[model samples]
Target: MRALHVITGLGVGGAEQQLRLLLRHVPAQCDVVTLTNPGPVAAGLTADGVRVIHLGMRGNRDLGALPRLTRLIRTGGYDVVHTHLYRACLYGRIAARLAGVRAVVATEHSIGDTLLEGRPLTPGVRALYLAGERLGRATVAVSPAVAERLRRWGVPGRRIRTIPNGIDAPLFAHDEVARKEARMFYGLPEDAYVVGGVGRLAPGKRFDVLVRALAELPGDVRLLLVGDGPEQETLRRTARALGVADRVVLTGERPYLPDPGDDAPGVVALLSAMDVLASPSAEEAFGLAVVEALAAGLPVLYASCPAVEDLPPDAAPGALRVTGGAGAYARELLRLRAAGPGGREAPQAVRRYDIAYSARKLMDVYTAALAGSTLEVSSP
Candidate 1:
C-alpha cells in the first residue's frame, strides 16, 4: 500500500525520528509529507529515498494552504495517511478525507493535558482538533498515558488504540571504541563523568532543572545538551547565572549522524559515552532518549511526571524520579552516581516497543482502518 506520513515540520524531535524509522522498516512503500517548510527531518527522509511534500504553512492557524493540501492528497492517491503531532493531524486528516483517502490515522505523540502545563484546552483549538480527529478512521497513541489523556478530552475510547513508542535497541548497543571516539571528538576528558540530555530546550522539557542539578554536581561532571528550540538562550543564561556555564556543552541542532555503517557508529555512540542520561522534562508522553540510553545499558534519571512514571521500571534500575526543582534533582543525581554507571538492567524491557514491532502494530492499525474494522483490539 502507498502510505503518507504527515507532520508539522521536519524538525529534530521524537515524532519525526520515529517517522524516519517507520519509513526505514515498514513493509509497505511509503512517502513523507510535511505541512511546514522542511528542515532536518525532511533532509533525513530525502536521504532515505522517502518522497516529501512541503505545504509551506506559516503558522499554526494557517488553513489557507488547505486547498493546496487537498489537491496534493487527491493527486497522490494515498491508501493510508498517518499523521503525527497536532497541526499535521488537524489539517492532514481533514484533507485526506476530502481527497477520498480510505484510511486516515493519527498517532498522539504527547499527552495533550501536559502539552501546555495543564492549562485548560483553548476553545477554538480544541474544537478544531476534535473536529479533525472525528474525521480520522483511527487514532494511535504512543503510550497508554497519552491515549487516556486524549480519551478524557472527549475522543471516543473505541476509536483509539495504544501503541507504545519504540527504539532501535541494537542501534543503541554499547560500543567501547565508538564511545571513546565520540568523547574524543567532543574534547571531553576520558575519565570525566558525563551526563547527557537530548531534547528541545523548551519550558515543558524543564531543562533549567537539569542545568541547576548539573551545577550542583562536582567540577568533574559534564553536562551535554543536545537539540535546540526557543529556550536555548534562556537556558544558556541560566547556566551562566548558576556559575556552571563552563561545564555545560550545548550542541545546538547538530545533524543526526547517518546510519550506523561500519565506518561510524551513530547516535548510540553518544549515548554509550554518557555515564547517565537525564530526562528532567516536566512533561512527556514517552521519552525516546531514555529508552535509547537504557538500550545502551546506561542509567536514566527523570522528573516525577505522569508520563515518565509509565516507563518500564524492570528494564532499568535507574529509571527513578526526582522532584521538579534543582535541589531535588541534585540529590537524585548523587544517589544515581553512588549506584554507578550501567547500574540499570539490560533494556530487554523495551523489546515489545522496538521500532520493528511498533511499525508492525501501526501497519495493523492502517489495515484495520482500510478494512473498515471498528473493533479495537484489547491491550497488547
Candidate 2:
C-alpha cells in the first residue's frame, strides 16, 4: 500500500534513524514529509529511493503549515498516514482526517512521565495531545512503558499498540577490523578506555554526568558524545571546566544508516571502536542506544531503559542500570576500566529487538488500520 510518514524534523535522532531503518523492510510504497529541518536523514531517505517533501513549517504557531500539509496528503493518494514525534502527531493527525484519510497512525517516540518531546507535560500539552489523538486510528508506542504512559494519559488501551523500537542487529555486530578503523577515524587511541554515549546532546540525556565522571578517572579515559543539539557547547564547557576537555570527543552526529561510500563512519563502526556505552538519561521511551550498543557486544550502563527493563535480566546480560549522579558513574567507570575491555556476543535482547520483526509487526498495524480494525490492537 502507498503510505506517507510525517515527522517533526529529519535530523539525526533515534526516531528519525529508526524510521529510515524500518522502511528498508516495510512491505509497502512509502513517502515522507518533514515539517521542518529536513537534515541528513531526509537526504538518506531520498538516496534510498523514497520521496521526501519538506513542508517548511516556520514554527509551532505557523498555521499555514496546516493547509499545506493537508493539500499534500489529499493529493498523495496514500492508504495510510503514519506520524512521528509531538508536533507532527498534533498536526499530522488533524491534517490526515481533514484530507479524508481514514487510516491515521502515530508513533509516540518520546513521552516521559514528566515530559513530552523534551517539553514539560503541562495540562495544555496533555489536553492537546489527547484531543489530537482522537483524530488517529492508532498510536504505536516504542515500548510497553510508553504504551502504559499513553493509556494513563487517557488513550484507550485498544488504540495503543506496543511495538518496540528495533535495530539491524548484525549491522552493529563487533568487528576487529572495524574497531581499528573506527578508532583511527575518530582519532581515539586504541588503548584509551572509551566511554560512549549515543543520543541527542541534550540536558535530558545527562551526558554531563559522563564528562564529570571523566574528570575523576585517569587521563587515558575518554568520553565520546554522539549526536548534536543545543547543549553541545554546554557539554564542551563542562569538560573544559573539569579539565578533561582534551580527552572528550564530540563526534557531532552520526547516522544509524549511512549512504553508500560516505566517507564518515556510521554508528555501527563507531560502536565497534568503543569499550562501553553509557546512557545516564533517566527518561527513555525505549533504550535504543543501549540496545544498539548491546548489538555491538559493548557493555551498556543506563540510568533508565525500558527496552532492557521490560525484558528479563538475561535478555541483556551486558546492561546494568546505574543510579545517582557523576559519582555513581565514576565508580562504575573505574570498576569497568579495571576489568579491561572486551565486547560480549550480541545478547538475547538484540535478537528480540530485530528490525525485521519490528517491520512485520508494524505492517500488522498498517494492515489493521487499512482494514478498519485499529480498535482491535492487542498489547505486546
Candidate 3:
C-alpha cells in the first residue's frame, strides 16, 4: 500500500527518530511531509532514499499550508495517511480528509498529565486536539498509560490503540570493547561512574533535577546529557551553578543510526559507555532511551516513566521506578550502584518491543483501518 507520513517537523527528537525507524520496517511505499523545520532527521530520511517534502509553514497560524498539504495528499494518491506529533495530527488529519483518504491514523508520542510538547496542557489545547482526533480513524498510543491519558482527554476508548515504541535491540547489546572505545571518544576516564540521560534538553525532562542529583552524588560520578534543545543553555548554567559543570558531558544533538547495519555505533556506543541510565523526566509518554538502555544491559532509574512502570518487574529486570526529584533519584542511583552490575541480559519481554514486531502490528492497524474494523485498545 502507498502510505504518506506527516509530522510537525523532521527534528532528531524521539518521535521524529521513531518515524525514521518505523519507515525502515513498514512494508509499503512510504513518503514523508514535514510542516516546518526539516532538521537533521530530514537529511537522514533522504539518505535512506525516502522522499521528504517541506511545507514551510510560517507558524502555528499558517493556514495556507493546509491547501498545499491537501493538494499533495490528493495528487499523490496515497492509500493511507499516518500522522505523528501534535501539529501534524491537527493539520494532517484535516488535510487527509480533504484529500478523501479514508485510512487515517495518528500516533500520540508526547502527551502526559504534566505536559504536552513541554508546555502545560491548557483547556484550549485539549479542545483543539479533540477536534483533530475526530478526523482520524485510529489514534496509536506509545504505551498503555498514554492510551488511558487519551481517553481522559475525551478520545473515545474504542479509537485508541496501544502500541509500545520499539527499538533495534541487538544494536544496543553491551560490549566491553565498545564501552572502552566509546569512553575514549567522549573523553571520559575508563573507571568513571557514568550516569547518562538521553533526549531533547527540555524543561519537562527535568534535566535540572538531574544536575542537582549529580551534586548530591560523589565527585567521581559524572553526568552525560545527550540530545539538544531550548534548555541547553539553561541546563549548562544550572550545571555551573551546582558546581558540577566540569563533571557533566553535554554531547549536543547527535545523529542516531536507526538500522543495525550502519557502520557508525551512534546511540549504541554512547549508551554502552555509561554504567547506568537515569531518566528523571517527570513527563514521559514512553521512555524510548530507557528501553534502549535496558537492551544495552544497563540498570535504569526512572522517575514517573510509564514505559518502565507499565512493565512487570521481571520484564525489565534492571529497571527501577522512583519518585520524582533530585534526592529521590540520587538515592536510587546509590542503592543500585551498591548492588553492583547484575550482568543480566535483556528480558524476553523486551523482545515484544522489537521494531519488527511493531512493524507487523502497525500493518495490522492499517489493514484494519482499511477494512473498517473497530479498533480496540490492547495491552503491550
Candidate 4:
C-alpha cells in the first residue's frame, strides 16, 4: 500500500511520536507531510528512511496552503491519505477530496468533552470539524470513549472506527540495574520513593497539582517530571513557593520510545527508577503513558484514562482512578506509599495494547478504506 500521512505539526508530542513509531512497523510505502512546524519528529522520520515534506503553512487561516497541499496530493499517486490531529484533518480531508483521492482516513487522537488537541472547542471549531469529517471515508478514535464522543458530535456510526493506541510492552520491562543508573544520573537517593508524571506540561495537564502535591509528601519522596511545554516555569515557581523545589526533577522532553542499546537511559530506565506514575489530566482521548507504566510494572494513578476505563476493570490491576487536584493527589500518594505495593507483574493490558498489534489493525483500516468498505469488529 502507498500511503501519505498529513499531520498538523511534527513536534515531540504523543501523537507525533506515535506516528513515527507506528510507521516503523507498518508494512507499506508511507510518506509524511507536515502542514507546519516540522520539528524533531520530522527529522526522526527521515532518519528512518521515510520521505518527509514540509508544506510551509504560515498559520491556521493560510488559504494558500490548501492549493499547495492539494497539488502535492494530486501528484503523489497515493493509494490512501491519512490525517492526524485537528488542523491537519480539517485541511487534509478537503485537500484529499479535491485531489480526487477517495480513500481518506483520519485518526482522532485527542477529542475530549470540551477540548480538541488541548484547546477549547468552540462552535466554529465544531462546524469545521464536521465539515471536514464528511470528506473522509473513516475517522479513527483512539478509544471507545472518543468514538462515542464522535457519535455525540453527529459523526455517523458507520464512519467511526475504534482503534486504541498501542505500545511495545517488553521494551519497558523493569530493570534494577537501570533503576540504579537512572537514579545515579539524576542525583536521587537510592532509598527515596520516586513519583513520576509524563506528558506535555500544559495547564490542562494539571502538572502544577503534582508540584503542589510534592510539598505535602515526606521530605525523602521525590517527583520526576517528563516532557516539556510552556508550563515549565510555572511549575518550577509553584514548587519554589511550596518549598519543594529540591524535591522535583524536570528532565524535559525525552523520546517517547528510544533505542535500547544507546548509552543514555531512555524512557524505559526512567520508568524503572520510579515507584509510581501519576497522570492528573482531567481529560484524555487515551491514556498512553499509563499503559507504558503498566508495562514497566509500576502502579499508576490517573484522573481520566479512557484507555483503562474502556476495558474490564481487571485488565489493568496496577492502575487506580483518582480525581484531579493537589489535595487529592497528596492523599493518594500517601495512601499508596503506606500500602507499599512493590513492583508488579506486567498486566493483561500490556499484551492487549502491543504496538505491533496496533500497526496491523491500522493496516486493516487502510485496506478497508481503499476497498470503499467498512471493517467491522466486536466492540464493547
Q: Count the backbone clashes (under 3 Å) in each candidate.
A: 0, 0, 0, 0
lDDT tens readout by residue for model 1, 111-161: 556463223457776777788889998899877777887888899988899
TM-score of candidate 3 versus the correct structure, residues matched by position: 0.95
> Between prediction 1 and prediction 2, which has the larger TM-score?
2
Residue-level lDDT tens digits of model 4 in 284-362: 9998989889989999999999988977768888889997588899999999999986756798767878778788888
Q: How accurate locally is residue 132 in candidate 4, as Cα lDDT from 0 to 100?
A: 88
Q: Which stretches of candidate 1 lie over 4 Å from their true place?
A: 116-121, 259-266, 304-308, 311-313, 343-345
All candidates' TM-scores? 0.92, 0.97, 0.95, 0.96
lDDT of each: 0.77, 0.90, 0.87, 0.89
The Cα error of candidate 2 at residue 162, in Å, is 0.7
Q: How much lDDT does candidate 3 score?
A: 0.87
Clashing pairs in 2: none
List model 3 lDDT by residue over 1-380, tens digit each. 99999999998799998999899999999999999999989989998899999999999899999999999999999999999988999999999999999899999999999689788999999899999899999999999889999998889888888888989888788888877887887778988889998999988888888899999999888998888899999998999998999999988776665344544346778888888988888788988988888888889888767777787777777888787689998988898778887784776766878998888789888988887778674565
Which one wins by lDDT: 1 or 2? Answer: 2
Q: What are the RMSD figures for all models against the true structure?
A: 2.7, 1.3, 2.2, 1.8
Q: Per-residue lDDT for 19 in model 3?
A: 93
* Residue 58 CA displacement from its true place in model 3, Å: 1.8
Question: Global CA lDDT of candidate 4, please?
Answer: 0.89
Candidate 2 has an lDDT of 0.90
Clashes of 3: 0
- Give per-residue CA lDDT, model 2, range 197-232, as digits (tens): 999988899899999999998889888888899899
Which TM-score value belongs to model 4? Answer: 0.96
